[model samples]
Target: MTLRNSDFDEIRVWDNENFVHPWEGMEHIGQNERTFTETADGIYVTTEAGKRLIDGPAGMWCVQIGYGNGEIADAMATQARDMAYFSPFNNANSVPARLAHEIAKRTPGDLNHVFFTTGGSTAVDTAIRFVHFRNNILGRPEKKIVISRQKAYHGSTFLAASVSGKERDKGWLDQAQGMSYFLPNVNPYIRPEGMSLQAFLDEKVADLENAILEIGADKVAAFIAEPILASGGVIVPPKGYHKRCLDICRKYDVLYISDEVVTGWGRLGHWFASEDVFDIVPDIITTAKGLTSGYVPMGACIISDALIDSVSGEKSQGATFSNGYTYSGHPVSAIAALKNIEIFEREGILEHVREVSPLFQERLTALGDFPIVGDTRGMGLVGCVECVVDSNSEDSLDLDKTVGARIDHHCQELGLILRPIINMCVFSPPLIINVSQINQMFDIMEKGIKLTTEDLAVKGLWSA
Candidate 1:
């Protein structure tokens, strides 16, 4: 095959043995991909194919600050030149230590103790081990099982994948776990015709309480949930729902862990969504993505004073903590993350989100009138426009690419980027996006929806 150097031919996805496309499937390995063709900067990727597409999703919702920030590059450069390689163990890098201190100062609660990792999966893994270890040290070794909501994504680690439901996007991992599952709170707006938000929360919380009584309170270690379901379609929660969830966790004396990997760092109009909107705090906060603004690989597991106190001065809880990554607080990544945090502060990314959030949401909410739009909902930048088998029916559209993929592809053709979140296509553009850009995104996105519906109708996939 005398192959010409086309777009994908130049895609620089460094495929080591461990590389797996995070949210994509194996069957989609090489189909209609703009993998590396989209490269230029500042909002749109000036593709080799000559498309100037607006980055509606902010490169997987991690590029908090806009692209091409020389300040961030310079920060990495300065750190590398000063001290490139050093660990945070014993006597190691001062960069991570300083970064930790700064993060502690910025994070909501006394979530003061920071443990670093290479990415979200590692951050989640660390939280899993830490929860087990903390329980054992606190003399509740029986409390080893974890409780998590359905459709929540923690990470790809063994325990995290196990914590998620049986059927999901990927079918790669087969880890063993004897964990308990609870009925998740259904999104208020998207609830079925007969269902009400209050009723849903009441039933779901009651289920958790009953589950606790059955499993024994002392047997459960922690309750993990993303503040808002990002991957499972940007499902925005109802009012006072999180507070009740928190109250239930406290009632059971179970440690609450917020998986802020998606919602943190201005994604939710605040630094940490746990503190910003919900006014709820958790014992541990697992995070990544925006931490380094996707510049360098980094994640962090932040813990409260109480949990840290439980593990303090206790080798009796099985010698050392028996966890940590080789790249835990890698100097370059730590440097990048540290600089990225500074960028967030210096640029006031959250303020930008606050200023434009109302306008951003108003346009999305207007999409609710669309014939195929089951729901257009979310907080801050993260939002979902669910397509149903019937806009007025309870059944969802075929989870296959039918409607969602058509919309995503249509958006790509219209010079906009989006992801098909289950039956919904999601948009969580960079917090740096202006009001004008927000308007442009929804305008293009609506066009994509119309095109998708028309295409599906031609294929007879349209809901009656």
Candidate 2:
């Protein structure tokens, strides 16, 4: 059936009245404007008016295999038709079982157990809960505090949000107080002005060790970290950071939870970036977004065999973790994940990412030459372009707030969509993006920045 203009208008009205979007503010509740995306395929989404734009953010950094893959769609349909819904709590299913094996074999170390969830938030929530559960099982109920870093984006669930260190997001929302401790920011770009990178690294590592020692390691349950802080403007920590942090965690017997929600499943040229890219096998790795390439909602908390064995087998009789979601290991999502893995292998997408990432990073680094771009950093397919204003002005934060959106607006007009986070424009294009498309994307981004710089100067908000 064809949708008429009136139908679209009615849909928009209904959306305004009924739909409460994620991260919606109170003032923008009923009068918010939004793009009506009509269709999408192959790294491009078509608007309602038939304008096709490159999905620069890759659908919130999830669309690894890109938009509208026939294989994934067929797998979802077949799984739905074969056996869609069943209680995973009391029963086991083949799709999830096979998918679990697929994930287990790819993950580093002995992280062989998989617990599925609906999405990233629930995955992180499950990981945190399990950490607490493990401590409780070991009779150390005081070991309930989680250590995280400033500006890290974990998830939106209660426990996950509690552990997340994005300060601005917590201003109006309530989180589990006193349950999480945050360290300083890890963005190397923000380190002290004359400090050597090695010294900066030492300071960051020292911060973790100090926190563990000061808090008394027995009270700290886990240190949750993103191999690369994705939502915190793609912040890449110093070299050997993860390995050093892992060492500190091991020294203090604190469990390490790697939040690879954005870095996994070929986004970093591997099925998992913990071992391959970051060189540390975490005790628990929470993954989503690219698990099914955002075809269907699914996430996982992959736990190490050692951690699970510590709690099982006669340690305490009749004890249960007793935590799960309704859609844990849903058949459709599991099958989709399996199919995603299959395509990654069959098409050599991981190899492609590794091969083309140099070009991606080169273009991203070149953006730093632009006066408005203060920093550009990334690895694999993910990247960020951060804009800076005159630091001397009191309105610096206010000026920075609109820089990204203004660049995004210009990029949209130029047929590219950006994920603007305050002063940063992040990019995680489809892993299948080619040389031509990469050039096109950065070309448009350059133009967008140019146009935005001109606009900012005209408005007297900033000048570089």
Top candidate by lDDT: 2
Pick the TM-score winner.
2
lDDT tens digits, residues 159-215, model 1?
777676435643666755576464554467646679877877787667667777778
| Deviation from native of the Cα of residue 219 in model 1, angstroms | 0.6
* lDDT scores of the candidates, listed in order: 0.77, 0.93
The deviation in Å at residue 360 for candidate 1 is 0.8
Score every model by TM-score.
0.91, 0.98
**Which runs in model 1 stand beyond 4 Å of their true positions?**
1-20, 27-34, 170-172, 314-318, 390-400
Cα lDDT, model 2, residue 354: 98
Q: Give the 10-residue window scoring lowest on summed lDDT in candidate 1.
A: 9-18
